[model samples]
Target: MREIRQIPSGSSLPDTQWQPPYYDAAPPPDPSQEDTWDVVRKIWRRKWLVMGITFGFIVAGAGTAMVMTPRYSAEVRVLIGLPDPNVANIEAVLRTILPNSETTQSEAYVISSREVARKVAYRLALDKSPEFNPALQPKEGWWHAVSPSRLLKELVALIAPKRNDSAAVPTADSAPMTEEQRLEEHIEAALLNRIEVTPLNRSHVLGISAESQEPVTAARIANTFADVYIEQQLMRKQRATDRANAWLQTRIGELQQTAHESDRAVEQYRRENGLYETKSDTVIAQQMGTLNADLVAAENAKADAQVRLAQATPRLNNPGDVDSLPSVLQSPLIATLRGQQAELERQAAELSSTYTSKHPKVRDIRAQIKDNTSKIKEEIERIVRGLRHEAKMADDRYTRITARMEQLKRQMGQSNDMTVKLRELEREAQANRTMLQTLMQRSKETVDQREIQTSNAEIISYATVPRNPSFPPVTLILVMATLVGAGTGILLALLLENLDRTFRTAEEVEEYTGLPSLALVPIVRGRSKAPGHVVKKPYSTFTGSLRMLNARLSLANENSAAPGGVMMFTSALPGEGKTRISSSFAQLMATEGQRVILLDLDWKRPNLHRMFNQPPGAGLADLLNGDITPEQAVYHDPASGAHVMFAGNVGRFPGYVAWIERLRMLLYTLSRHYDLIVLDTSPALLAPEVLHLARLVDRTVLVVKWASTPRRAVSSEIRNLYSVGGRIAGVVLSQVNPRRYRKYGYDDAGYLNPRHLVHTAG
Candidate 1:
């Protein structure tokens, strides 16, 4: 058994003028109270809904995959070979300059080109083939009825202009295309869409693939595309070679004429100018060379003569200095005179030593020396004159040579101009001749190579018929559909959950109502055998919740200044189990040895009498109308051990406004006898009497049905009660499903275990 604390009596009543904390509006939800686990719990609760939607999508995807037609694909591999060596070298040079990847990509683009598709379509006649043309095939099922393509085609046909023979018609020749052009576009589109071209990694190999409903058609299209590509390559090479040959032939002729004209012009110019070619050893060249040598030699001779004149003229001024001159020394007359002078000087020296200064022998020797010296001086003068004469003759000879050389240089200058003109003409003719020979050789080579030109690509492997389809992989489709559907379903579930305005947990009630949840009453599935089931099943969860609620109400009553006061039970809407909660709370309080009274204050539709199995006779309505006394109206139930005042015959009573004073008197009278007064009032939203009763009561507890009543409705009713100065103690969440509450981890796992239940002796 659980212990119950005795609430103190003689407490003063709470102020009737008290207003609700959230009188204007409902309180905002606290963000800290809402955690990630709350969201996870919400999603977990709707897991089945999400899983069902995902499975449905997966099934639909599988069905779609099964309905789709299987398409077969065939491939052909071809090598984009290097340019031919025998043909024009320009193609080979271009290939070398381009990167390998670029060339391979170019080849792939050509393979998938619309032009190539047209060629294949023309060869295969695919426009008329039923396999390729969708319109030509027979309609199989209603699947075509919903096709967007078919619908668009039908709409186009309806709006299209009709052709009439009587209408003014344009001439057929004015159009560039023939009647076949109408079907050509359709065939090209179909072929292009069916073909796939890809290049191998870093290699000049292209893979051309074609897809179709029929394997044989796919294989044939692939192979035919390969053949067409090869033929196109060969044709392009041949055309290039032909163009090269034609251009070379035409250019060679022009070059030949140019060379001939140039040669003729050179010869004519040479003949008219009277210019002749000359070697380095020619006569004029040799003359110029000789002139240069002679000029150098004459200048050398002049310099020598000048030097000799300078030496010889200085010596002629002194007779004694004549002995130093080689010319005078070599002369025989001068040498004989020199010897006589020396011998005379020697005889005079000996005589002067033996006799007086005036002696006759000394005098005769001195006279002889003077005569020899005069003769030597005369010979030296003669030699000096001969040297001057020789120098003059050499100078005159050099001057004559210089005059002749200057005359030869003037003649050589005239000859050199003619030689330059001859050399220019010769070079022009030689160049023309060489160019003509080269052009002639290139022309011959181009002509010979034109017939043997080859393509730069070749087919390596032909396509074979494919055994399997490439599209509509059922497993992959199902997997992807499942993933997408699961994501969408989870998102939708979360959105719906957020849109729901109901309260699911105690935290929500507290956060939104701005009041503590006094109790969380687990849902009782069926009606009990008696209204006093709380006392009968004392250890049950319902009874336990009721006991807890009784304790909270007692505490509220203790807190108020007035003890033994009324605690009204009401909800935002009807059918929220407020009556049951009130009855159970009264019974639990009575079992705890308290004087409790359960009042059926719902005048419009009262149910307290039904719960107690009593007749609707002489209850609150009779007492309020002064037809009965308080003792006569109050009936005690033995099972619940509490007094019940039923709302008897409300149709016979006066209106609620007229009976307000009497109702207040009746409540005050009951408060005097009972320790706790529980009022089961009508829903606040449905009855105005609930507000009146709430104003008269000491404490008002709003009963909120869990996961069923909207928070807006509860808050609105709460705001109404508060508007009229009603004292709301707190809220109580009724009818909480225990299993769901446990799933949310709200209930302590071992707290309510069977071991905790005390078994009384029978």
Candidate 2:
């Protein structure tokens, strides 16, 4: 081992000269605080994408609203009181049995029925209107049968083979309709669909609303629908009445003829057997009663004649009792003679005293008494002869009556059979009359009802012209579009962030690689052309960050395995700003008046010589080949006053173990000449010697490009170095964009912004 040459004080020393440096086991890795700013950063990074998506959605919404057809709506309210006009119900009387939810719905259904639609369509000529008739106009909306998307789907379905080999079952009646009837039906259905009938509050009232392209047409459709339904109901009632009248008239005629025939049969049967009726009795029984009464009257006449004959005999025999005899009392002349005889007798007796009756003379009274006696006798004889003749006539009449009565009794028995047949015929006539009467009454009542027939439902409110269209709410569409766009954009941003598996923050590097982040080296434009800018622009944030890195590396010597002067830069991959970082680091140290040298040991692709105005030849490779000493191979940058060694003539010599001794001698000689040695090694994963070189360095600074280096690669390489006894001082984040890095949720990243940094030359 060579003796230490100008090594800075307070630098870490190797435990042994022959052995590799002892890794300090980096002070427990940073906790890597997590906060809300990380999420904000991801969103901010994609804010443009979010806005673009949201704006696109808004435009689409506006376009859709413009393309949609406008519709006007009108409603006609109707009250459905009862189910049927022909029947009386509690609803019609008390009006308390209101229509239930189901009944109300049924009424609404009827109002919106296909039949009603047909009537309204006919009235409004909906088939001719383009709004309801597709045949009259081109179909609306984006999708039609011949549209590109639909054609594509049909093409695919036609070309694509079935997954199964079985043949498809043919659908029944799958024939396509290509007729005017189909178009007419389509128009009818379209008209029906435009109208909505809803029950209002579970009552009998229905709201028949219709939508159309024109407000007047919508109102007309609703009003006409209600009017047609009511008209149809009235027509039904009238037809029902007419049918009833016709049936009743036909039935009444048939019944009247049947009654006449039955009455004729009863009369014929009665006449055949002499069964005549008076009140409730037959004619044979009446004739029998009349014959019996005539016989009694004849006997009474005979008795009266016998009595008068006896009285006349008594009166003729005794003239003094002649006045008491019936014949004498009945004969006016005889009575007068008796009275004269009595007066004559009294005159004769009273002649001596006073002349009273017939006072002509006593002699004349005696003569008149004698004449009266003779006249009384003659009257009694006349009475006896008339009595005898009357008696004889009475006896003959009585005999004739008795004989007729006996004949009537015989006829009555025969008439009893006729009475039975007659009664049967009479009952049939009565039944026909009863049915005729009933039908006649019903027919009369129906005629009366027809005059006052009314509809079951009436229109309570007629539709009026609508003021506005009822579709394509533009404001609502826009708001929804905005929400959808924002949500999709946020999701897209999150997806991109997750897909980006690079380390974006110092916290990420520390947490992933288990190493302290020494510094965040901001990216410098055209750094390749001016690699010495760390010293060239000493006040720039780029140069300031390099100083910070240098300071941190120096301070880390306390916990590192090797001296602070021998610092090497590497990364998980090439082009991670390691070379630029190492060169700038060396220049910054040189500007501080310390002896600093940067060596490009990236055997595959070294870029350090570009930092200085020098040719690329005979540098690290020459040193590794033992062809030149370290002092001879070092290239100097005149602008930054620093020394740099580029990868020279890297012709791919022996790989891993070959350069160990030469590399050590070169570092050993360089250590004596320079106060700081900055080694830019190849990507850690790409070269096996990078790990070997890491073992020999005082401190290895793992350089990870910000938002560029993969976390897995960085962590794996850091673990590999620790496993192989290599000293990793810490990780350095290179090429950071302060504007973007600010969102990375770091406290110190704010100062890295260009706004806070200097850019003037030194």
Candidate 3:
């Protein structure tokens, strides 16, 4: 069985103080709360660059809008009527059958329809318009006085009504065949393309809109369409009435002749029979009354047939057919064929109004009519045969009656003694005939009333000339464009921000390394000759920040076990200003009246020789290897009054533990002479130089390059230093941007812009 040991808390037992082999790595920074504000801060941090890019897009969009041809639009309103209840059994008829939905659909279709659209095109006379004319030019404006092409682009941008540039395209003078006429032509076609027709949903109103180079013209086109459509409707109704009246008149004439003849035949039959014109002779008089009723009915049927034939014939021939036709004449196949033919005719009419004769539809209609004529003739012949057979049957019945009457007349003459009986028979027939005549007159009046009611369709409301224009809603269009532009701009900003990968702030350094930032050193130019020493002057921002950092570090551990301990300087990689920081810190300490020693522990690449203006010679390596003494290898930095040592003549791959042990011994020997030791070690992660040196150091300072050092490299370096017994003091973020640091929630008031600094220094 395994046993567990209970160790006292906070006690440094042999095993507890052994230190884990692995470095306690700081967990990764969470980038989850990155909100819109973060993106905005980033934009502000890179304001100039972002502004330049966004402006580029705006300019590009504006330029594109400029090159495009200017256009305008107009509109009109049309109201469609529902069926009138007063006409033709309206409720019942509607319940049984209804007009095609297209009756209303055409209102919307009219916007794209060749008929209405072409009329607008013709009215504007766009067919002869010139595409490009140098004579028509833009005039000088405020934008014109700016960079080249500004004026034209600005003019094009003035699509809003308040900013319209009417003078952009010049009008041609009538004297020289003014461009106005040509312009109108162009405007005409443009208006057709810009035209829109929309039927109000679930309503009878139609909105027609059109666009052109001129706003007023766009309005005019819309109004004209309304006027034309109304005029067309009125004309169609009048034509329909004329056709109805014509057929009614022809039918009335035929009925009048038939009625007159029937009256004469009745009069002759009464005279021949010698029947008294009284209501008593029921039998023979009733027979005459029956014949009159039959004649009236036949006349009425003929009249109705004539009216129907007239209505259907004219309608079928009228290529501008109504959307809704009478149900009696409706046939799906016929309607489809006619609709196709009507469309072809309509298209033809646009090119030439006289196209009715030579159009393909006209040819097809002629063929259809020829075929229908044969069928109609055959149907008429069959109906005529049936009528003839009925006429023959009536004739045969009359013959038989006449023969029986003749025999009765002869018998009556022979039996003159039965005169009372013949007289009584005559009286009865007369009485029945009088009642029949009264009934026939009433029937005739009723039929005439029905026919007149059926023939007429009342004009409910006359089409009025429209007072307001219907198109080119500039406010709506401009608003939509602006909103679209704004949304697109925001999306573009986010996409660009996500694509950016540059390190931009001091907080990022602290967050990456889990260390407090000591200082943000600006990248200085033309300072190649400056000594690798922290400027002791309190006036410099960099030096002041360093002093602040030192004070904060010391105060943080005032009651710690060790005070004024070793501080090591290292970085993730080379060229991150680590050596400069180390030298500067040592100089800063020495200037503060504290003895400081700056050691170059980067055995692979020693830089202290250059800083001290000394040659690379026998130093720490030779001294530690027993070739020389520590006192012989140490040198003084004359500029900052600090002691320095170059790690010299050392192999690139020295044993880490052996070197650290010897280095610790040398440090312990020098601790009595120097109050502080600043070791400038090579990049910890890149090489084991810093890790080996970390064991002898009391605290470590990692140098990071702002907007250059990757977070992964810094974190890895910090972990490596810690694993080797290096106590992380803090980080020194180099090459920081004041604006970016402030944006990342830091007070960058003490920092100066690098460019401004260089300018001031120069």
Candidate 4:
């Protein structure tokens, strides 16, 4: 005898502690709660696809860089110094004569100017050089090789008729440009595009560069441009100096002529005025000078005479007081007489003191004093007469000189008018002479400085042939292409994922259908001879998935009053593996020591008998037609340990409504004996019979194909089943890829081992 282990109707484990291992049937995840890892896992699963796209772009970019024409750049450095002070001085005199206003900046502009470009092109004959002329150079790039322009040109050339080579005629009406003009224009345009000028920061240096297909040509063009610029500067300086010199010479000549005329005018005025020179004295001037001296002497003599006359007149009243008169005091005779009289008076005074008023000594002294006084008076009269005569003579002389001085003033006034005209002429002549001298000095200095004038720019370095091309760097292009390709691939992957409307995980089925998921069944690669995979491969992942599904179903049954219930398996569409799942599930329940029966209620397309390798026989249809009892129709599948009943020629039964009622009766009878009865019905979406069967069953399990079934289709079918009052236990995702299943956060490998279950022998 063998003992069988059976799972209780009521599970001891809590729902939170132990859920079905195949699927997490918890409430649908919050829509707002985003899963970043889920998106990352999707991208990671498709990483190889992205890497392949990136590599393709890299290869394409590398090929493009390889076939591109090589271009080289050559640079020539120039040192621009401050404007020469000499040149600046010349510019002051002749404004706009020099082009060295701003040292480095102006030079850079000049180097990039069209005139300089034309000059450089002409010097190098760039119009004839293929390097400068795009029309002259051969087309040599991958784009050019593949271009339609090349093909068109070739085709046109082939189609056009050829003209006679030797007898070409020239048209006189055509105004074609001369070779010189053509070359000039071509050179100008070529140099303009090829040349670049940049000023160095905070320095008087400029970089003039040229780019070309050939290394040597680029170097030659740069150096030639610098040389041509210097030559142009020298030519401009020479032109300016020549012009200044010519102007100075003309001005100097004019000044010399004016100075000569001024000198002649001065001489003519001197001769006309009877003046030897401006400084020579005139006759009136000489007479006035002599008269002025005589007048001064006469005035002095008059003053002296007046003083003598005044003294003499006052002394006339006292003739004996001759000594008071200026003339009398000067005479020696008068002085002697006064002395004798004074001595006599002294002796008489001594006698009178001793004698009476009439004493003989006193009377004799008085008579001597009278005689001396009379002699002094006579001398004073003589001196007064001499003084009067001398004063009158001085007055007459003063009067004569005054009359003569007045006459000379009239004559000198006439000479003054002539002197003013003479002075004006001399001033004009002197001014002209000074101006001429200044002009001559300036002209000489300008001539001396002309040869030393030079531009404020020089070439500090010359361009050399470049060794490497500057365009189409292969490594950089490839790296950029790789990054772009990777980004594009990732975006494409996400876009496709959003457009896909299939269920990828068990959570997706539960969320869309609003039902808990019973299990996640992996795709079985090889088809089994027996449809019951849970019995044939008990240790496989498929068997484990079935076991988990049975456990979930058992728990549901335990919660209900009907422990042994009719559980029907159906899908949204045909070929969702519902039939196989139903058969496998019943076998799984039987293996756990439960009395389970598998029924094929899909009369429209019955396939249960084929799954069990049983031939066509009496099944549920035969019982409803009263041809056989339910016990006679039921067949035991020893391999799965479950009884199977087929549809058994359901076409013979014409009344489907009555058959549906009989089917319900059949299920009720089976439920009395079996712990679980699984009915494999037609897809709810395709067959109308599925809805009837759904109402008869205790529970309805919706089977969905993983990553293949459309979400809308599954959802619609579930709704239809529910509309009929069907008891929807949960959903089951079938045919899931195990490798991809693990990525959904479920441990698919953990359920593959069946070692946890011990099989007892009967």
Candidate 5:
């Protein structure tokens, strides 16, 4: 037994508030910024689960590929040829087409249409084939009852409301289709599903692909589509040509009738009017033309005569003036008279100048001049008379011509009405004859076209038998399954990791609780109750862990007022190895020549006495009540050289609230004697008394069973201790599984089971 010695008054610990070193604890790294190796390690920790899932997916993929049916595909390429436009500018709607993108797509649609599908189905007798027609196959077996599709359909039926849509819909003759028709339709639908029509590169060429169990049948089906489509096109063109010819023949007869009627009417009209097809104009028109020309000439003559008379009449009062008229002056007799009169005048002027006015020569010349003037007048008058006579003749001729023209106009008016009617009838007959000739020519062409019409679609390439199946791509499925499996496994591992909220490493404890993790104690499997691992293997990994814990506590107390401080071991919940850890620490301290007392203040569940292999005894309570001295009351452990104080008659242990001061006094008295005192208290959460006890101790070490204690409970207990002003030194990750701990990639437990070559003499 350790001897009790006097303790100085200053040996009592100073009242110091616990301040968690916030800066020492690093903030958790962002998950995105976490190291890649960290993620790898986390996944490696759950490798078994991941590998199992991956293997399951691989097997499923291989199984699915093996079970799937293989289908062979064959392609038939057909080029759609546009029909030649009609010479008559009348094109067949289906035959003449442009090869535009829309046209190509439309051709593809035609190749895949229900009509084409039906034709292909009938040609192949698909309705009688077991593959295309379900009705032709044997009845489904009992396995069909438990099929996923069947069960899902049954579930949907149960959940869905019953609808009466037949009453709201109309039916032809209120009758259902016959079974054969229904079967054919079903086969056609199935054929359509198996057939794929694609307008390759948006061109006029169409690729018709068909899938079947038999490679030969696939090729046959594809080829049959092209044949049926072309044949259908030919049949349509022939029908169209026949209809066109019939219509043309009927129109020709109608045109003949119209032409005959028109010709007869024109002839009858011509006979009634006594008309002939001599000229466009009539005899009255010719007569009128002659009269017009004569009338114009006569008018011109009469106008000239009147103009001459006008000029002569104005000057008739003076013969000399009349002689100045253009007509009179033009006459040869008037010209002669003017010349003689001028000569006579010249002779008279010469006589007058030579002799007296009464002279014989003057008298003679004057008389001659007078005689010539008289003759000129008479001539001028004659010319005037001629002009007047001519005017009269022109007037009479104009009047006769005008009278004749008036008669001709009357005749022309009467003939014009009959001519107009004749021309209209003749035009109608000519139009009917022209149209009949065109129709007769077109009818001949239409009748001939039916024999030589070409198909709009031409098969550019024939389909050949395929050599391989296209469905159930095994390699691709296996690869995808592997990828999906790995992804799912990693996802589930991460999900479970996130869900588990436990302290896994010292860093995790420090980061979560804002307290320094003092140590990592490897789990001593099956020896947790007593920590006997510290005895036989004194320098093993387990003892080394306890040494680390002891060193940290010693270092913490080095700066504290009391070097020999009281440390209480406690945890959030029971069964966290707190008692074991406290006992082990006390025994370790004693072995190192330190006077340590292991006190079992957990009256509710005392375990220190059992760890020392001792029975019931008076412990701290008896010592405090002055019932026994330290030597008599405390039992010394021989194995570890530590003093033990078990809870004596725990039923007599007083109320925690009233006994807190007593417990504090007892700890101080033990502190004076022992170099260290370890109080093994009950779980902080299980016993509220632990919180009161925590404040009396110099430092409180929280014992957390690694990966077993929940983080929230640790945080709650820490808060409780903090509220009571307990000095929490740090945390201990107790009972750590070394393998899993290393998997976390934390090297804090590197000293445990290290892989190294120790060169020591055997």
Candidate 6:
């Protein structure tokens, strides 16, 4: 047979042919899923918490609605149309005068400016509102404006236009401001607030409407805007008419004076010079006419020469005509030069294909082409310069002949006619001056009429008193309140659920410690009659949970490798039901016909002696110090026939290492006779007792107190136990409160009711 080696706890198990028995319950799932579900289910089960949170939000929203202040709005419309027809179009006119949607919307924004709002504010005497009046309470008035409650309402009203139904201004003389006076400035703000000026789509008409706290004020503001704009238009038109009339008068006088002065000058000059005949300066006129004729003839000749030159020249370097240069270039030397050029061209082509124009071969080819081109250009220029000289000579000859011909003609016929011709030319000049004066007068009058026409944008319809109020959307408010309330409520519930670290259910205990929770012990409100009485068996509710714990250990028996069914109860901290749990587990096992031995392993606090009604100084400590034998230290538990061992004298006990080794050997000796051994160990965080006793036990069970242990300390305790050589049997939930558990969907009655368990104690 192969020797089986026992593996120490916390260290990796030795590789041996061993198999743990499969459990009926499913294997522990990934903790993330379990933790997440625990949190979610806790929140879902606690529906009252979420409902309470939602109600709070709903109440807040209702309060907000009641506290909000009311606002007013108004609007007025202006129509854009063609200027009075009497006016003429200006040079920059783009389209026919028609109302454009884009322009209307832009102008509406301009009308809603702060300057406009201030004007309206002043007119309406809104510097002191009923809610904002300083005389009512100056301190409170300022506070209200700055308050978040007040700010929200005003901001909403300003940005989102809505109708309002506020009472009209009082008409009595003692009223804050007269109805007319009060509404004036308010109308301005109202105009800015609820005013909507929409141009009919694809049409020239505009529709304007205003909503306000006071319906009459809305109407008045709207009508006033229309009237003011119309009046402004009229003033502009009148100014234009005045300017036109003045300009026309000035231009008429200036034109008449110019005509008279020009006529007088011409007549006077003609009479003094004795000029008459055909017209003014006939000699100079004839010379200019002859020069113009010669210029035309020269230009025609130049055109013909340019055409001949174009025909004579051929394009060099034409790809299509390689042989076009001439057969004379076929000499051996020329052929040699051409071959060299072609070779360079081939090299250049290849280089150009792969590299930039700056490459060496490309640059070399370009330089060669440039030199050949320069030589060819020089030859072409020489030929063209000769042709140009011939054309210039021909033009010079034509100019000299035309000038002489004009001089001869003037000398032959116009000698005595000079004075008469000068007089006639002066008369013609006077007539032209008079015609120019008449045209200028007419142009000035037309300009004056145009100026008058440039000044009109029509006010087509006026605003009327509004009859409806526009806000306090109840439906909208309620809907928002519902959504905010529900979401915030759920969030609050989840927060509380996550923050609570109490162990209310078996799932929670297993989730934090990575161990199965075997049983839940309910809290007892009344006393059990005797002082420090040990109810080890299921004779009372306090001891019943132990029976369930015994079943769990039995299940673990088929799984762990250790032969002895040694049990140890430990916790993260003191007062976590470790001693009580150990006592009950031993008693329950003993009642099941198994011989049980209960050891008080926690020398620092020997509590088992108190539970068994035995003096603490007569047990394990005395036996270890050679003061008594095991037979003298052991006491029989009357409740379940389980034997109990008390700590003899804590002060005289051996060190934890020596005592634990001795205890383990003792447990092995007693295991041959007893079916179960239970050790009640101290908190590992406070002392090393639990760690020492861990080696003596076959399995360990952690006791978790309800709502008492800190979650971080619990996690650390689990990690500590795993670090040592110990096997975990399961967890036990002690002192559970039924009412509190019910909120998390845990049914306390299902676990506590007596009818569920079948007993065979008979």
| Candidate 3 C-alpha lDDT tens digits along 363-417 | 7656665665455444443443444455555556555555655665565454443
- Per-residue lDDT tens digits of candidate 2, residues 616-680? 88887877777787678877777667788888888856555677766776777777777778888
Q: Which sections of candidate 4 miss by over 4 Å? A: 1-42, 82-109, 129-191, 199-205, 233-455, 506-514, 526-532, 555-564, 573-575, 600-638, 646-660, 682-693, 714-724, 742-762
User: How high is the CA lDDT of each candidate model?
Assistant: 0.74, 0.73, 0.57, 0.73, 0.77, 0.61
Residue 251 accuracy (lDDT) in model 4: 87
lDDT of 5: 0.77
**What TM-score goes with each of the models?**
0.72, 0.63, 0.56, 0.66, 0.75, 0.55
Q: What would the TM-score be for candidate 2 when compared with the true structure?
A: 0.63
- List residue ranges in candidate 2 displaced over 4 A: 1-45, 82-98, 138-178, 199-209, 214-216, 230-450, 456-468, 526-529, 559-563, 652-655, 754-762
lDDT computed for candidate 3: 0.57
Among the numbered candidates, top TM-score falls to 5
Per-residue lDDT of candidate 4, residues 1-762 (tens digit): 111122233332112222122222234345347588767776776677778888888887777677666667899998766355564243333333233437567777777777777777767777778766666878687868675445544665689654332112336875776866665666676566667888867666778889887888889989988888888877777788788889889988998999999899888876776656325676667667778998999999988998888777876887555466657777898788888878878877887888865877678778888888777777677778878888998998999888887776776777788878878888988998998887777777777766576765689999999999865566787888899888887877766666667877765665666577788887777675357677767767777787778767666664543335677899988888888888887887788777888888887688988888789988878878999877898898787678888888787875768887777667666667877788898888889888877667666788988888877788677667656656678888888777766655454334633343333110
**Per-model tally of clashing residue pairs:** 6, 1, 28, 0, 1, 28
Q: lDDT: which candidate is best?
A: 5
Better of 4 and 5 by TM-score: 5
Candidate 6 lDDT, 205-281, residue by residue in tens? 55556555566766765665455445555665566556655665676676667667766776676566443334645
Which residue pairs collide in model 1, if any?
11-561, 11-562, 12-561, 12-562, 13-561, 13-562
Roughly what TM-score does model 1 have, to 2 decimal places? 0.72
Better of 4 and 6 by lDDT: 4
Q: Cα lDDT of model 6 overall?
A: 0.61
- Candidate 5 pairs with clashing backbones: 523-736
